[model samples]
Target: MKVYLAAVATGLLLIAESANAISVNVQAGRHFTHTSAAIGDNSAGLSFNGNWARSDHNGQLGSLGTAFSLPVGPLTASIGGKALYLSPKDGKNGEALAAGVGLSWTVMPSLALYGEVYGAPPRLTSGIDSYAEAAGGLRFTVFKPLTVDAGYRVMNMRGKEGNRDNKLADGFYIGAGLNF
Candidate 1:
């Protein structure tokens, strides 16, 4: 599992390094009691976003694959697909892919509200049955090249254990991220 995770992370890093426009994101969150954590579970991840096009009506721009954003009146609608690596502490760790779509509304020049959902089916990741996640939050621009975001995320994963349905991770989480 460690080898698998290292390989996946290396692949993602290589892809991001060669991408046209790239950004690095770091996020941290806490899981609820319903999750696998006995006392409290804390989750964190680093992601590299790359190959972004210009943002226009029906255009492709932002993080993930083929990301695009459009200004619908005063709101922005965006969607993208992402392939990710999973290294859960309580389950079989592997790789998975997710297709995500989101909507964002800018309340002010530096503040925006957004919500997104991502889903992956069985067999998408090795040794995993299925996974799904959803998040909603607010983002605030603190400086020109820096942004801060806080959100609530819910994630569920089922592991492949022969005929047994192993619930790996499931519950709500509160997280924060830095985008640059």
Candidate 2:
């Protein structure tokens, strides 16, 4: 856990140097905590992101990815791929490469909605049969650079062997974000 935290912290520091825009988010739930950072702008820039999550059921999961964003009217759409490393408390560790899409819409100056889905088939995974994740949330901007959000997320992984399937995270989470 300490190692993962350090890696994310280092990534954040690196991102702060050259990114035109940057954001960091932290989330917590009953038995789960997640942290992520991204650097880029919505109009058209290469976005780099990294995330770490720890859960009672899954132990830990971490990912790194890059995305390209395109703006259409009041919405922004992104396409990306992520490389995921998963360590389960009672199962074998695994790696997966997932392809994903995300969409965000600004409803008002202060409110927005966002959703994303990522998945990896058995062929794109190792030590695990498959991986999938979906999340959506409503975000409220408290001010220009601060926001709060609430959301539901579900992440699942199926191990190669039976009895190793794990629901890494499921249910609601509340989070806050800083954008600069």
Candidate 3:
């Protein structure tokens, strides 16, 4: 994991900044895995999907950061981080910090293929481990301000004692978003 993070951090530092516009996303969904905090198992609220998206796993209460959508040769890149305040339904408080990089290819004007890689280490000690996830999916712009995202994600987390034999936990993600 250390090597993976070092590689990504180094790559981000080397990539040339380009002319890109900023967009923000705020959506709410079910909490799975380490996301128990912020948005409990059965809760609905705002989610972070903006500049600091990569860093913010679920929706830490107070999180702030910046990310970029850069245009590569034929695909776009997503890079950013977020630090959120964690508050669970069981009266637990902590923080989750994350960083990620993704790529998107627009095959058509309104349709695109996307993939992302996320690595986030929690700051609080509530039985969560440093995790990493990779996913791919399809995105379609339904309207001028509406978009849909459907994807499957595979992730791995350090088990009880940072052992590597534990089975990884991943899930499928399907939903829509609005651009304002």
Best by lDDT: 2
Compared with the true structure, what per-residue lDDT tens digits does model 2 show for residues 67-91? 9998888898989999999887767
Clashes of 2: 0
Q: What digit string (tens of lDDT, one per residue) describes model 3 on residues 110-160? A: 998988776666453334445455778887889866777777756544433
Residue pairs with colliding backbones in model 2 are: none
Candidate 1, 88-167: lDDT as tens digits? 44456566677777778889888888887877887666646776667688878887547677676555555567533333
Clashing pairs in 1: none
lDDT value for model 2: 0.87
CA lDDT of 21 in candidate 2? 83
Candidate 1 lands at a TM-score of: 0.58
| Stretch of 10 with least lDDT, candidate 1 | 35-44
Off by over 4 Å in 2: 1-19
Per-candidate local distance difference test:
0.53, 0.87, 0.51
Question: What is the alpha-carbon lDDT of model 3 when measured against the actual structure?
Answer: 0.51
- Weakest lDDT window of 10 consecutive positions for candidate 2: 38-47
Deviation from truth (RMSD, Å), model 1: 14.2
Give me the displacement of residue 84 in model 2, in angstroms. 0.9
- TM-score of each model, in listed order: 0.58, 0.86, 0.53
